[model samples]
Target: MTSARPLPQYLVSRFHGWKATTYAESSAWYRRLVDEGQRPRAMVISCCDSRVHVSSLFGADSGEFFIHRNIANLVPPHAPDGLQHGTSAAIEFAVTALKVAHLVVMGHTSCGGVAGCHAMCSGHAPQMEEQTSYVGRWMDILRPGYDRVKDLPEDQQIAALEQQAVIVSLENLMSFPFVAEAVERGTLALHGLVQDIANGSLLQLEPSGRFVEI
Candidate 1:
């Protein structure tokens, strides 16, 4: 058997406050969205980090973005084997059904998921290598990124690999046939972003193979 519980009181209170203020003030917009449908222009794939507020970071309004969050903000290579794939499913729908114009894979510094992948690959965390480790299995998608940065000095290794996380996801996202077609037709654009969690600085990767502060 499993257990379920109500939301915490503090969060509930905050929700009520938001409903009374923001929701009430934008009731018409909310009703319009309900009557029509969400036609988000962009799809943001971000990490499950509690500190990364996708909407807040972009100052986005409701229904503006179709967002998906996963560990390390990873996108595994496309595999149409009739298996369950939550992230890939979201990407498929965004590219095919919703026809989003942009797909952004956002990574962040000090990410626990990225750090765990680094540790597991470096043989620093044996428990993560166990067969029962779901996180480890999921993070295997990032092993190539770790391999790319493994030779760097220890002080610069994790941060370098963090950027590689974004690179890997960007590469994987393009592996989906539909996504690739959309980009080829100029209907969709791909983006990679990395944030400095400690300083709130943002960097965006350019097509020219550089990451510049934005």
Candidate 2:
């Protein structure tokens, strides 16, 4: 059990800030959209963490992004899971259905799953638990990085591996039939982004280790 004092103050403050925006949406506008769904221009794959919100980063409204959040923004190739992969579902809807112009797989700094990627190899990670659901499954995409940098400090590896995983996820996305066909026809653009959470910055991933400010 945890005490109230252990909670972070930012949550309290941000919730209040959110209420201001939540109140700004007129009821009639929401009703119109609810009855008739708005088509979003892009699909963003981001982490489920509360702090890494791509919608807020892009200044998008409720239905403006066909956003999908996982433990990390992982896109596994379409296989035997089901006809509906949540991340794949959003991408297919964006490209093949809505015909969105862009699809971005965004990574971020200070991710817990990046740390968990390191932790899993340490023989200390929890196994087969509900709370560990997505992290355990999705973080597998970063296994190569985790093994490569097992000796690095958590803070350093978080940025490095998160960016690497972003690229890897992008590669995985190409394996999907819809995404591949769309790219081949030049109908969609794929972007890889890294959000620098520490300095309140958004960094676009360079092929090198550096990320340029957007």
Candidate 3:
């Protein structure tokens, strides 16, 4: 069997620093969390971009949010084929088991995944069209989103597609029975947001299907 390598020195050092400072200051709070278990009120679906810090963005402490990160912050339509579906599994747990009050799909500007989807759909990224490309297949979920913004000027497409990622995920999330039932029962609410990385500004999707800066 292949053995895992030792942890990176930089990460190890950071862990030690956190333990001595942040963890030490909050040790009792941490213990209470471990004993009580997490009961976060919101489930956040966010991009896997390194710059998109979900906790920092929301001023969330540990155990404050149930977060799920993906390449494009996507939630595919419900498929009960018994295959592995990590995002769906997380959603199911958050909605059913955790009973989170809110589910938020947050996308961001300059998302590589959205950019790739635009490129692939625009016929500029032939490699992403190959069947064997996992990223290509995953980004296919955003093809419908691409079609929505394809006619816009080239400079505006990527930004619009980024917001569409959040919209698409929110739409797909409703395809899950548990999520839909919760929403119908008034036990769950869904929100969609897009963040601008450069200025740390947020845009929220309103009931009218338009994004307004907040």
Per-residue error (Å), model 3, residue 143 = 0.5
Question: Which portions of model 1 miss their true places by more than 4 Å?
Answer: none
**Against the hidden true structure, what lDDT does model 1 obtain?**
0.95
Candidate 1's TM-score reads 0.97
- For candidate 2, the lDDT comes to 0.77
lDDT of 3: 0.95
CA error at residue 25 for candidate 2, angstroms = 5.4
Structure candidate 3, residue pairs in collision: none
Task: Give the alpha carbon lDDT tens digit for every residue of 62-127 in model 3.
Answer: 998999999999999999999999999999999999999999999999999999999999999999
Model 2 lDDT per residue over 1-214, tens place: 6555644789978876776677455656777778988777788888888899787788887778888888777777667565556677777777888888788888888888777776675667767234557667667777766666667785676667787678778888898888888888998888889888878787776657566888
Taking every candidate in turn, the Cα RMSD to the unseen true structure, in Å, is 1.1, 5.7, 0.9
Clashes of 3: 0
Q: Each prediction's TM-score against the native?
A: 0.97, 0.75, 0.98
Ranking by TM-score: 3, 1, 2
Worst 10 residues of 2 by lDDT: 126-135
lDDT of 3 at 55: 96
Model 3 spans > 4 angstroms off: 1-3
